[model samples]
Target chain A: MKPLDKIQSIAAYLDEDAVDTDIIFPARFLLLMDKKGLGGHAFHERRRVKKGETPFILDRPPFDTAEILVAGKDFGTGSSREQAVWALADLGLRCIIAETFGEIFYANCFKNGVLPIRLDADTLARVRQAAGREEEIVVDLPSQTIVLTGDETISYDVDAYRKEALLLGLDEIAVILRDSGKDIKAFEEGQSRRAPWLRLGPDKWKVFDDLEKEQFIE
Target chain B: MHAHDRPRTLYQKVWDDHVVSTYQDGTQLIYVDRHLVQEVSSPQAFVGLDAAGRDLHRPEAHMAVADHAVPTTERTATLREGLAASQVARLSTNAARHHIPYVPMTDRRHGIVHVIGPELGFTLPGAVLVCGDSHTCTHGAFGAVAFGIGASECECVFATQVLRQSRQKSMRIRLEGVCPEGVQVKDVILAVIARIGVGGGVGHAMEFAGSAVRAMTMEQRMTLCNMAVEAGSRIGLVAPDETTFAYLKGRPLAPTDTEWDAAVANWRELASDSDAVFDQEFEIDVSSLSPFITWGTTPEESAPISGRVPDPAAIDDPRVRRRVERSLRYMALEPNTPLSGIAIDRVFIGSCTNGRIEDLRSAAAVVAGRKVHPRVQAMVVPGSASVRLQAEAEGLDRIFSEAGFDWRHSGCSMCVGMNDDRLLEGERCASTSNRNFEGRQGRGGRTHLMSPAMAAAAAVSGHLADVRDLWPEGTK
Candidate 1:
């Protein structure tokens, strides 16, 4: 993950609400475990060029190279597939602004270094209008502001911890392992003592293992 | 020491019990009691773990299953050369290498992660369960603090067994009165989503309570919580009661002998205090709910069976209107058209949402002595292999087979178009799955979300028909 301090790029608009993860990254490609080169599959159906069909916004000139996406309400909704974030990030999109986002998708964005911004409907419309005009947008992480054409700037709120995570490109697992190792172990020991029923040994596994060994074929 | 005296919701109790420490930035490191993994979303997490030189923190706390892309028919042979095979193989290899318990594809216990976890008694009351799949919240019917996490978080749990998290506000949804005849528990949840909209539960943990909720069986409660993600809530809860306890009493993984008594005593306390306060509250009378189904793309774009397709022009909000128009275009539906008369090409009767044995029983009851409409290709995929065996033992599979509905193996079949069971272009389906998002079933496919009984009725009638019409004595 690259540290994201500032981004300036042309914005693309998608005028549809509740654009789900399946739409962003279809389930057919979910079997590809590797996360690289998923951008080609992002909005796979929409990007397809058929005879006598209008070209998709992302496939049009200027917007074809866009680094920011302005979407409608509840964007990135449905499915817990993080590949939705990966697909956008792999597509060279650095930022996504929407009225709202699915909570899991929002969290997945920070993990993959793609910034998700939640703006009010009015502010979102302004962003969309700016994108429709093909204005180059600048998003400054440190200032938490989006700079549009004519130097018009709009401020946004982000979780302080997430903002820091994005700015520093911190590996959360590494941080937790370093700072909370003892704390986690202590909690586990205490929890086991309190509720011994949760600690299952090989005996519990015997049934599943026996079944697996006996019946490995369909 | 007086923490016990303050009235806290069920979410608070479960959260408080699991907190390991608090970071300076106010993110709490909560210990996870269970981590469930499936094939599709877990492969990359395992790769990350390998790259980080990390081993499992507590292997016993994790379990894996393959359901997302596994073929319902000819499982192994169908997966022999494709991407699905490789993915399932990776999960199997990852689980074995990490010493994690994995229920293999052909194992009798094998099934959708959410379904098997509860039935096998792995999902415990007051436990913190995280899975890579959103439907992990289905376990919340056991009064657990369960939510879905992304792959990065999956790797984090794999290494440390803790998550850095901020607290979500609490919302209590109280369903009062009994559901009218022909209105299944699935209808109750659909009505809630239709009332609350898709984003209604955002940034909150929803606790489902009241008379209707209390009256539901454990399977029904699971169905209710399973679709909470579609309502945009990561966590969903139901206070553990006798229904939950009774469901888990003799399960293989549940506590037994003297330990069972102690576990029950502990679970009995897993409820909201009498005067507990919630950040938001919603009350709905279930008596008025009808058999509900989504006529548009989003789950919120649904109405009672008697209603008509919503007209975008009639809606006041421009954003909502545009969304409705786009959904109507994708669904090929006309505004003001009756929802009941919409013809469908297929009927899918399995998913983490409604693939349990009781769901099968209800659908089988409706399909008994009736043949599937020739125009509709209908199939029933059990939630788990055990669910399949139980259904077979009860002769439900025979009823479905005799009725010309494909009685298939257990897996998340047509709910997601990952496997062979998919909708062809322009094909519309009546599915018992959760979402109705554009192209969710197939690239150009349309979906209508409903209950198993409703889907069965749609199968026989070749259109969206009210299940009440089939039940002459009215549904019990």
Candidate 2:
């Protein structure tokens, strides 16, 4: 993942609320485990209602190259599929401005170097208007602001940790393993002594008995 | 300071117990007690781990199963090569390489990740459980601090056995009063989602309490907590009690003998302090909630069976009205039409939400002397093979098949629409699955979410009929 500092592009507008993960990236494509090439499947329903036709707003002229999306409240509201972000990022979207986002999706956006910004209703209305006109918008991560048409700027809030992670393109797993290894080892050692039953070893598992086995096994 | 000195909600207690490290930004690296993996969401996580040259930190603490990708039909000697097969194969290889406990498709214990976790006693009180699927909240029924994680987080768990998480505000929803007759546990959860709109529980850890929740069986409690994600809350918890202990007693992975006593003693303390404060609180009288069902797209876009399709014109909020109008259009429903009179093309009675033995028995009881309507193609897919066997032992499968319904093998089935069991385009279905989103069952497929018994009733009547009106005589 590359560090995301700023993006300047037209914002594609999705006017619907509760634009859930399923709608963004349908559940059917979940079997496609490879994260790449999902841009073709994002919003699979809306992008092409028929073969050889692209009717969705994102597929249209000026918005086709959009790196920013302005959507209604509760965007990415269903499922914890990270593929939703993968698909959007694959679709060339770098930032999403919404009234609110599903908490898991919001967290995932930062992990994938996609910024999810929750703006106030009034500011969101202005952003929506700018998106409707296909006006160019600039999202600057360092400044934590979205610049709309006519130089009108709106500030947004993101977790300090997530913003830093996104800007630096830090691999969170590597960072944790490097910084917190000792603490993690200590916690586990202490927990095992206090609650041995909680940390069962492989040999301790007792899932089946020979007699009742007939009931569970084929 | 002693842990007991500070008043804490069940969530706070569990969160405090799992904190391995805290960062300056207020996020904590919380140790995960149990990790459940399924085929669809896990393959990429394994790839990422391998790409990072990381080894699984605790393979013994994780379990993997191929549920969503497996067909709910009789298994062939081997799966034909394809996307589904490749995904399942990848998971199997990953499990073997990582030494994680893998339940193959042929294993009787193989079932929906959430269902098998509790069934095999892998889920326990006070454990911090996670899976890539959002329905992992089902484990919270046992007082576990369980929630869903993305595949990236799954890799983190594999690499470090901990996840970085910020604290969530606590919300307690009290289901007061005795549940009225004809109300299923599914109805209780659906009613709760309806009360708190899909986004109502966002950013909060929901604790289901009050008398009605206490009266529920472990299976019933699982049903209630399974759809917590549908309400936009990542976690839904019920404090462990005698019911929870009884359910865990002698299960395959559960503690036994002296260890059992010790585990139970610890679990007894996994409850909210009497005077603990919640960030937000809501109380719903279960006595007042009737059999709930989704009439439109979203889970919250539902009303009681006695109600009619809402007229979008009557809605005051333009955004909500537009959404409703679009939902009604896709559902092919008209305003003011009685919910019961809406005809269906199919009936599907299963999912993590309502696919347990109890759910099967309830549906079977309704179809005991009846037959599926000639126009309806109904099926019952158990949550797991264990659940299927248990249902068969009780002869529920016979009742379902005798009623002209398909009694199929266990998997996610039509609930996810990734397998062979799917609704054809524009097909209207009365299903027990959680989500009713467009294309959820299949592209252009319409779904009306209901309880298993209600789904069975729809199979018999070929419409969204009330289970109460069709209950077999002499049965409650």
Candidate 3:
């Protein structure tokens, strides 16, 4: 995973709210979760340049090199396929500036070192307009602001932990292990004290292990 | 909590209970209760784990199963080759190496991950559950705060058994009015999504309540919660009640004797308080609600079974109108044509959403003495192996097979176009599974999302027909 910080890129627009994982990266190519060779497959059907077919937005002017995808509300809405984020990242998209995002997709973005920045509705409108005018957009993680051309800046919100994780090139588990071992131990103790039944059933293996002592089941 | 401060909704309660600590950046370290994993989304997670030299924090908490990647044709069929086979094989090896228990493809316990988890009683109330599949939200029917997580997050949970989280606003969808016979819970959920638009529940926890919802069976509740993600809500919850306890009472993973009583007592407190205020509220009167069917590519583009395809001219919004027009083009339908009279090429009655034994029984009753149309190729794949066995013991499988529906093994068949089952180019289907995205069934395949009974009726009639119209005697 590449570390993201200050990035400047032309923006492409996908204005449909509830832009789903299937539309971003269809299920047909979701065989193995690889991060490379997926950018071309992004919007696979829509990107095909068949005769009599109109070119996809990305194939159109300005958007040809656009590296920031400005999607609509509820962007990345359906399915938990992380390959959607991988496709965008593979396309060299460093950030997705959207009004809102599906909770799972938003979480996955940070896990894969891609930033899903949520902006207010009015700010998104300006960003979309910026995309039309071919304005270069800037997303600075340390500064926590999205700067459009001409000095106009829209401050965005990133989870405090996530911002630090991005800055430090840390994934959630790495962060938790490095900084939150006490919390994990506390959670385990609490679970044992309060929610013992939550432990998996009397080990199916344990009951069978006794017989396994006599013979391996397989 | 002050008077102005509303009682915490069920979502807030569970979320707050799980947070180990909150960071300045607004991410909280939240403990995970159940992490259900499947083959399609987990192979890479295991790879990531191996690369990181990390092991599952609590392998017991992670329920590994092979669902989406295995064939539904025969349990004995070996997956020795291809992408699906390798993925399934990797899950077994990963589970074995990690000391996690897996309900293997040939095991009687093998079923759709979502179906088997609850059947095993692993999805407890007041817990936060997650899986790599979107239908993992089905577990929220037990009053657990369940949602889907992506593959990378699956790796995160696999390592720490926790997640970095932000809070979601809460929405309470109260299904008021009488639910007449034949209007299944599937109809109620689809109608709710249609009324609330696909994006209406975005960034919120959807907690279903009111008369019609309370009246539904556990299977029906699962059906409702299953598609809540389609509405863009991560969490879909129905407060735990006696019905929930009854279903959990004697299941394999559930407590026994004295512990059972104590556990039920604790779960009884999982409901939202009377004064709990939701950020959004919606009410749907089920008295006159018809069984719903999606006519467009999105689940929200739905109408009553008896209605016509939405006319683009009637839509004032140009963007929406164009989308509807495009959807119609893909679906191979004209604007004013009745949705019912559309011909069907295939019918599928399985998936985590509607592949339970009850779902099988309902579809079977519709096709009991009738044969599937010659033009339609239909199939009934159970959600789990146990569900298949139960349906068989009840002769439901025989009924479906006699009706010309191919009864197959357990897995998510004909849902997301995986496995060996897929629709041909331009073929139309009536599907009980959630999702009607373009080519969700197969490349260039059209889909009409409906209930299991409706799918069965479409199988028998060779077109999208109303189940109520075909079975006038009412649901058995």
The global C-alpha lDDT for each of the candidates, from Candidate 1 onward, is 0.89, 0.89, 0.84
DockQ, per model, reads 0.63, 0.51, 0.47
Can you list the residue pairs that collide in candidate 2?
none
Candidate maximizing DockQ: 1
lDDT of 2 by residue, A137-215 (tens): 9999999988887999888888888888999999999999999999999999998876767886876654532212111
Q: Each candidate's interface RMSD, rounded to one decimal?
A: 2.4, 4.4, 4.3
Q: C-alpha displacement of B65 in model 3, angstroms? A: 0.5
Off by over 4 Å in 1: A214-218, B1-4, B75-77, B472-475
lDDT of 1 by residue, B1-476 (tens): 32878999999999988889987887798888889989988989988989989899889889888898888986444565577778887888888889889888877888999999998999999899999988888999999999999999999999999998998999999999998878898999998998898899999999999999999999999999998888889999999999889999989888899888988898888899989999999999999888998998889888888889998889998867888888899899999999998999999999999999989988988889899999999999999999999999999999999999988988998888898888998999999999887778888999999989999999999999999999645446
Per-residue lDDT of model 1, residues A103-158, tens digit only = 99999999999999999999999999999999899999999999999998999999
Q: Please give, for residues B407-462, the per-residue lDDT of candidate 2 as tens digits.
A: 88888989989888889999999999999998999988999998888898889998
Q: Candidate 2 docking: what grade? A: medium
Which has the higher lDDT value, candidate number 1 or candidate number 3? 1
Pairwise TM-score winner, candidates 1 and 3? 1
The sequence of per-residue lDDT tens digits that candidate 3 reaches over residues B253-360 is 777787777778878777888988789998888887888999998899999889999899999987688788888888888888898889999999999999998899
Q: Give the 10-residue window scoring lowest on summed lDDT in candidate 2 chain A.
A: A209-218
Please report the interface RMSD of model 1 to 1 decimal: 2.4
Error of 3 at B467 (Å): 1.9
